[model samples]
Target chain A: EDQVTQSPEALRLQEGESSSLNCSYTVSGLRGLFWYRQDPGKGPEFLFTLYSAGEEKEKERLKATLTKKESFLHITAPKPEDSATYLCAVQPGQGAQKLVFGQGTRLTINP
Target chain B: GAGVSQTPSNKVTEKGKYVELRCDPISGHTALYWYRQSLGQGPEFLIYFQGTGAADDSGLPNDRFFAVRPEGSVSTLKIQRTERGDSAVYLCASRMNSNTGELFFGEGSRLTVL
Candidate 1:
């Protein structure tokens, strides 16, 4: 079974604090790693997609990096508006479009 | 709209009743997906559609759950004999094509089984 585990189920950070959320996975084959941000009572918003090990992508204050076994979402100088549940999902190879997602890490940036 | 759209922002139904959730994917998007999300958990895949055909449905839990995308633009998910366990947010997402990995999601429909 393809499984994803995210650590630190919830994290509280001060404004401008920098930290990283972890997403570890064991998949049959890695196709793409995705990051999404969801707010309360709303759907998830696409953030980034990392396709290979040693690949990194960034947008604004967020940076996503992927490895052979895991992915990391680094938040730099986060603000209150950045507070949301960050989700990690993987699309396994072999022509599969379904994504296996981790439980997600709820991040709160307190100003 | 430019993004995916879902109907019935909230729905409350009694157990054993039938329910249907609708999804309207973005224009020109050929790949559509349905996922269920519970509190404190990520979205769980239910089905996927490519054009008017169901490309994958391995994630559907049981026979009671069924979906159709006849026109290939609007889709509906029907649940028969709904149970309390079925209460959750139903999310619909769409991709431009199989070549792209990012899925644009909607606000989701919150289902409450009473």
Candidate 2:
């Protein structure tokens, strides 16, 4: 079975604090790794997609990096507006469009 | 529409009743997906459609859960004999292409089975 595990189920950070969320996975063959940010009462917003080890993508204060067995979403100088649940999902090569998601890490940035 | 849209933002029904949730994908998007999310958990894939055909429905929990996308642009998820365990947020997403790996999601429909 393809499984994804995210650590630090919940994290509280001061405004401008930096931290990284972890997503570890075990799959037959990883086709893609995805990161998303979801606010309360709203759908998840797409953040980044990492397809290969050593790949990294960034947008604004967020940076996502991938390794052979895990991925990290680094939040730099986060603000209160960045507080949200960060989700991680993995798609196996065999499963065309299926995504196995982690429980997610709820991040709170207190100003 | 500019983004994926789902109807019936919130629905509350008695157990054993039937319910239908709808999703409208973005214009020109050929791949549509359905997922269910519980509190404090990530979205779980339920089905996937490419055009008018269901390419994958393996994630569906059981036969009581059925989804259709006849016209390819709009889709409906029907749940028979709704149970309290079925209460969750049903999310719909779309991608311009299957290989893109990036999916745009709708606001989601919250279902409460009483």
Winning model by DockQ: 1
lDDT of 1 by residue, B15-68 (tens): 999999999999999999999999999999999999999899998999999999
Per-model TM-score versus the true fold: 0.98, 0.97
Tens digit per residue, CA lDDT, model 2, A1-111: 899999899999999999999999999998899999999999999999999999999999999999999999999999999999999999888756777899999999999
Worst 10 residues of 1 chain B by lDDT: B95-104
DockQ of candidate 1? 0.83
Return the lDDT, model 2, position A74.
96
- The docking quality of candidate 2, as DockQ, is 0.81
lDDT of 2 at A6: 99
- lDDT per residue as tens, model 1, A7-110: 88999999999999999999988889999999999999999999999999999999999999999999999999999999999999877778889999999999
What stretches of model 2 exceed 4 Å from their correct place? Answer: none
* CAPRI verdict (incorrect, acceptable, medium, high) for model 2: high
